[model samples]
Target: MRKILTLVIIATLTLGYSSLNAQNYKFGHINSQELLNAMPDKDSAEAKIKKYAESLQEQIEQLQVEFNKKYQDYLQKRNTFTDAIREMKEKELSDMQQRAQEYQQVAEQDYQRFQAETMKPVIDKADAAIKKVAKENGFTYIFDTSSGVLLYFSDKSIDITPLVKKELGIKE
Candidate 1:
């Protein structure tokens, strides 16, 4: 009975020690924001969004010019207008101004949606590449330094930016 008890204890310690040794964690980190910025897809997406914004701005400017022209005309001829005409002109100007403001608000919202939609695939590609690199390289925990959520990481934390870039076929 004593010999069997000793054997059981030795077997338990050996298995426990081996399990502890097998729990070695490999930590890696990558700056995902920098990776996304470096992607060519992102550059194209930015250019497209910029062009859309410029077009929206041009439309806004046209609305402003139309408003200015009517306002100037109303100011010049206010005394010539009958009371009814004057009130109608003022209401038109007010409605035009309101429509322009609403248009601006809508344009702002559309721009935001456009930006997010255009950037989604680019972001997803970067994320997939990061994930592939992490899994292939046996990273137990891959932290995103770009998120700003990670306050500090020691020098030993691996920066896998190059690996992710390579995985994504990005030279830069």
Candidate 2:
């Protein structure tokens, strides 16, 4: 019975010591949005996406203008046309409208794909910088405060944003 009590006491002490050791973890937080915005690559990627979107908008606008002109011409000339000719003209206009709509949808999808492709490298670079900073600084866990999901973190936790930005060679 004495040996059993000694064993239990040893086990309790070991568990208490392990729990205390676990409390020594180094936690950190960073505003990822701030990091991303500071990246030079992000600015260029955004500019590329904006330009691509504008080109698509211009194409859609041109199509709309062409459609409007054809529709107006049809309205002005419809009374002079035979029934069969009018039907053919109407079908042609309908086909043109359908093609324009299809092109707009395709352009929208292309824009999304382009934006994703353009941003992927920039995002990867930022993630790598953050990971490197965290590892070098002995951070056990780095939470993104920019996501707004962290309800509360003590001020005792380190903010590693500047460290990560420095790792990426980003100024200020």
In TM-score terms, which candidate is top? 2
lDDT of each: 0.94, 0.95
For model 1, give the 10-residue run with minimal summed lDDT: 19-28
- The list of candidate 1 runs beyond 4 A from truth reads 1-23
lDDT of 1 by residue, 1-172 (tens): 9999999999999999998976677889998899988899999999999999999999999999999999999999999999999999999999999999999999999999999999999989988898888899898889999888999997878999999999988896
> What are the per-model numbers of colliding residue pairs?
0, 0
Residues 58-172, model 2: lDDT tens digits: 9999999999999999999999999999999999999999999999999999999999999999999999998998898889999999998999999979999999889899988
Give per-residue lDDT, candidate 1, residue 85. Answer: 100
Tell me the deviation in Å of residue 124 in model 2. Answer: 1.0
54: Cα error in model 1, Å? 0.7
List candidate 2 stretches off by more than 4 Å. Answer: 1-11
| Cα-based TM-score, every candidate | 0.85, 0.89
> Which residue pairs clash in candidate 2?
none
